[model samples]
Target: MDMLSCDLDRTNEIPLYEQLYLYIKREIIEGRLHYQTKLPSKRKLADFLEISQNTVEAAYEQLTSEGYLEVLPRKGYFVMASEDLEYVGKLDVPIKTDNVKNESFRYHFHPSIIDTAGFPFQQWRKYAKNVMDERNSDLLLLGEPQGEFELRTEIADYLYHARGVKCSPEQIVLGAGIEILLQQLVLLWDAKTKYGVEDPGYHLIPRIMKTYGRDLYPLQVDNSGVKVSEIARAGIDVVYVTPSRHFPYGTILSVNRRNKLLNWAAEADGRYIIEDDYDSEYRYSGKSIPSLQSMDQKGKVIYMGSFSKSLMPSIRISYMVLPHQLMERFRSELSFNNSSVSRMDQHILAQFMRHGDFGKHLNRMRKIYRRKLEKITEMLKHYADKIQVIGENSGLHIVLVVQNGLDETLLVKKAETANIRVYPLSQYTFEKKYEGPPQIILGFAGIPEEDLDDAITSLMKSWGI
Candidate 1:
């Protein structure tokens, strides 16, 4: 085997060795260099290229480190197997593409988005800068595999006081988002975990479970919350519920059903309940419901929460409280998994929680959103004869069932004519399809307060109400 064409740019800002490395790497990726092709010996290549042997050696070492080249005992460096290459070369063919831009809506009632206007950006920036100080220099490195101890401790303290969740720092595990934590929980399962989720659930829960190869059974959500009878009859080993405020529908799990669900978990082996206490901070009416984990004496409930809804979504911080049983499994099997969240972000959030900024932020958002909801409620009253409002007591969004004559399709189309966007509630259903009523979800948090009246007026005119 002979050496392929090799060149390096000396004038470029990139180092000579790095230039040589990129040149050789591209040759292999472009199929110019075949498998088992021997590279030029460092001494020989140095002499041919009029460069020092050390320079050639450095380039060869990098290629070997990256698995592009391998050395035989007595032979020189040879290109690795073609299949071992990390990237495959593609043809550079030009094709015609569409230049059309996506259409924008005037008013969008997206349920997932929160009110960003009230976000404590300046306060967060201060904490972020504070974490970068010399005293916290160790935070720059990989500090904790689970999460930063300070953040976990702060989360535990906040949950206990705010949501009545019982846990310590040792039981808390932080990750980038709830999706990541759900995947981790699935991986922690030891037995055949047949997971049961609400029919019109958060939607992501079932998808994540499916990705992890778990059998998902959709349980219908009745007047209270998830049907406990359906869960018991399904013979499910795991149950995921948003008891504090069910997503989209905003139904709180009644205490009667909570006990039955707990009893079901106690009777069965390898049974666990995942209580997603998401967005429990902003209840406008009545007392905030205690977390299902707070009621569990047998450690059956795994409490999950995130700052995405309460704070900003880009924070990428979510946490889970593992029961003693799952906590042991997480330690023994998945403890080595590095925390997905950054240590700096964790420290900043910890400081925010400790300084009571988080609590203050939630209080302010509650009042802001409550007032917004009040205006929205008053606006929707004009169409009360044509629509029935649901899930307005809590959460950022409300579900409106069209009562005049329009179905989900017609309602959305009519709303679109007014430059307003609305989401169908049926989209949240798994296999059940939620045929009770043709409902649409309208989020008031992200919309401007001043535009609320105009958006509603446009909808009324468009719908001929």
Candidate 2:
């Protein structure tokens, strides 16, 4: 317990008290300090270190606040057995060192069509001011774990009219994002729930399902969307699908496939379907497809929607329309966990929807995206002989199917060397072998129309077209 013997270096940039705090925390994490070990009196340590008693006291206070130590009346301080010191210490460290060396640090791409500089900050500020001016004390506190009532109701109304989704505000369970809601669904249906994920799908869905220890059935999808017959034949307990606009491929699920899938879910008693309606609002081609939930006569589909793609990713507000029978169960389980969307953002979003600004914003973005898509299409036409650009009829990204057995990995690396970001279709496929031609999934939504020509030129050169 002699502090001087421990070599306390005061010359270091860190303060004396903070240094002491970190030293003790590291000792606990390294297992050098065992549980229930009594420490020498603070006064004694202060005397040994030639430091003030207050400094030792301050360090102890910080340790106690962080749950590293506990104080018993007349018994002094003891190391806390409840604290996860080792896990906490290792949290900030990198998870995988090998991957860090091979891959670029930048993975998430910013769409070209999205004008971040043009966000309606002034209008948003006005709305925020109005909310604060008419503050409700109840609203200031956590209103509901599901969501603020007004936002859910507004969303219900919006979906019913716009997307043809049938549901009441009560059916809408709001959360931070689709990932959180998906995890909740997996936990809800924990017993032998086999999730049928689209092969070559959004990579996150399969990863998340596996993280939760759920069995996944990789369902193959083609130009017509997920093979509904195969899913039914496999007898999956739960099916996760993107019907509006399929991820990475941009193929809309055919109405025939959609109907069959619904019928299959209905036939399999106690089975459910999750329809991820992501990026459907910004369709550049024909009318926006009706949601899978809208076609459900059996009420078995759980529709998942997010504001991230349409609005901003950081907004983190997503919702699901649950079946009537499962509503009570969802509420009962979620009531204990501190998982709820922010009330302030919810209020702002609800007001945006109520005032019809949400619709206006969508219209504005759609026009911008359409114009950008046109310019990109014109540029790609020059290299049509080497690459076929598909899926430009809708969505923010287009698929460039390589012809003549081109090496897609080399194209990706060459594009990276030229400071252009492009994703290979192979990255999304779960199976080792795929029947489709090699393609590159190039996103145009995150780039500017002015830069489209130059970017496309660089990409074409990289492909040696």
The best candidate by TM-score is 1
Model 2: number of backbone collisions: 8
**What are the runs in model 2 whose C-alpha is more than 4 Å off?**
1-93, 96-113, 404-406
Please report how far candidate 2 places residue 407 from its true position, in Å.
Answer: 2.3
RMSD of each: 14.3, 11.8
Provide backbone clash counts, one per model: 0, 8
Model 2 misses residue 254 by how many Å? Answer: 1.7
- TM-score between candidate 1 and the true structure: 0.77
Steric clash pairs (candidate 2): 110-446, 111-445, 111-446, 111-447, 112-445, 112-446, 112-447, 113-445
Instruction: Please give, for residues 223-267, the per-residue lDDT of candidate 1 as tens digits.
Output: 799899998788899999999899878999999999999999998
Cα displacement (angstroms), candidate 2, residue 332, comes to 2.7
> lDDT (CA) for every model shown?
0.83, 0.77
Could you estimate the TM-score for every candidate? 0.77, 0.76
